[model samples]
Target: MEVFEPFLAGIDNPDHRDRVEEIFNWVKTRFPNLMPKIAWNQPMFTDHDTFIIGFSVAKQHMAVAPEEAGIHRFSEEIVQAGYDHTKELMRIRWDRPMDFALLERMIEFNLLDKQDCSTFWRK
Candidate 1:
C-alpha cells in the first residue's frame, strides 16, 4: 500500500481511518494481483490498466465506486446486500458490515465485463 500511504495517512479519524484500511486490506488480500493506486483522491484497484473498483470515506458512510456499469449490473445485488447506491457509486453505511462477497461479485463482473476495454475507465 505504499502507493496509498499519503492518502491513508491523511485520514484523521481513527475509526474512519481503520475502516478504510480494512476495506483496502480486504480487497488487497482477496485479489493480490490487482494493482492498488490512489486516483481521484481515493483508493482504487485496477487490473490490466482498467479500473476494477474504488473506495472513499465520508462522514457517515463509505462509498464504493465500481464505476457506472458495475452499479447498473449489480443494482439488485447491492440492495440485497443491504447497501444503497447511486448510478455511479454504492453507499455502505459506516455502521454496517462490509460485504466482501458482494464486492467480489462486483469486481469479478467488472473484470469479465471490461475484459476488452481499451481504457482505464469506461466510456
Candidate 2:
C-alpha cells in the first residue's frame, strides 16, 4: 500500500490520522494505479497531470472533493440519492468505518468518464 506520507503528516489527531489512512487505503484498493500525493496541503489522487479527486480532514468532518465536472455530472444523482452537494463537492461527515461505497462509485464513474474523454480526443 502506497502511503501519502505528507498527507499523513498533516493530520494532528491520532483518530483523524487513522480515518485518513483508511480512506487512502480504500481508494488505493479500488484504483491501484492511482497516483497519490499531497497537493494544496491535502491528499490528492491523480493520473499524471489530470487531477482525479482529493480528501482532507477538517476540524469536524472529513471532505472529499472530486474534480469539477466529476461533481457536476453526478449532482442530480447525488441529490436524488439524498447526499448533499455543497461547493461542488460531496461532503461525507466523518465517522469511523466511513461509508465509502458511495464515494467509490463516484470515483469509478469519474475515472471512466475521464478515460472516455481521452479516448474521444485520441480518436
Candidate 3:
C-alpha cells in the first residue's frame, strides 16, 4: 500500500480514494507474491515483471485493466457483475458494488497465464 500512497492521496474524493485503497490492500493481502508498483500513472501488480493487473481512476468510475485477453475471457461474468467494459478495461461505477471474487479470478488467471512470459506486457 505504501507504493500507492502518493497516487491514492491525489484523489480528491476521500470515498473514492478509500475504496481504491481497500481494493489495493485486498489484492496485496490475497496475493502477497505480486509485486506492486506505479506505472503509466496507475497502480499495477506484476508477477516476475509481467503485468497481472492495473487500475486507474476516471471521472465517474474506476477502471480495472486485466488486459484484453482477461476482458474477453470474462466478458460474460463482467456483465453479470454489472460493470461496463471495453476491450481494454472494465469500468466499475462509483455507485455500484465491486465484484472482488471476479477480480481475484482475473488476477489468478493472469498470474498463471503469464508465469512464463519474459516481457512487461503480453506480446
Kindly state the number of residue pairs that clash in model 2.
0
* Model 1 ranges with Cα > 4 A deviation: none
Clashing pairs in 1: none
Per-residue alpha-carbon lDDT of candidate 3 for residues 1-104, written as tens digits (9 for 90 to 100)? 68999999999999999999999999999999999999988999999989999999987999999999999999999999999999999999999988999999
Query: In terms of TM-score, which candidate is stronger, 1 or 3?
Result: 3
Give candidate 3's whole-model lDDT: 0.95
> Could you say which candidate leads in TM-score?
3
Ranked by lDDT from best down, the candidates are 3, 1, 2
List candidate 3 stretches off by more than 4 Å.
none
All candidates: TM-score = 0.94, 0.77, 0.98
What TM-score, to 2 decimals, does candidate 1 have?
A: 0.94
Q: How far is 100's C-alpha from truth in model 1 (Å)?
A: 0.7
Q: For candidate 2, report its TM-score.
A: 0.77
Off by over 4 Å in 2: 1-3, 76-83, 116-123
User: Which candidate achieves the best lDDT against the true structure?
Assistant: 3
Comparing 2 with 3 on TM-score, the higher-scoring candidate is: 3
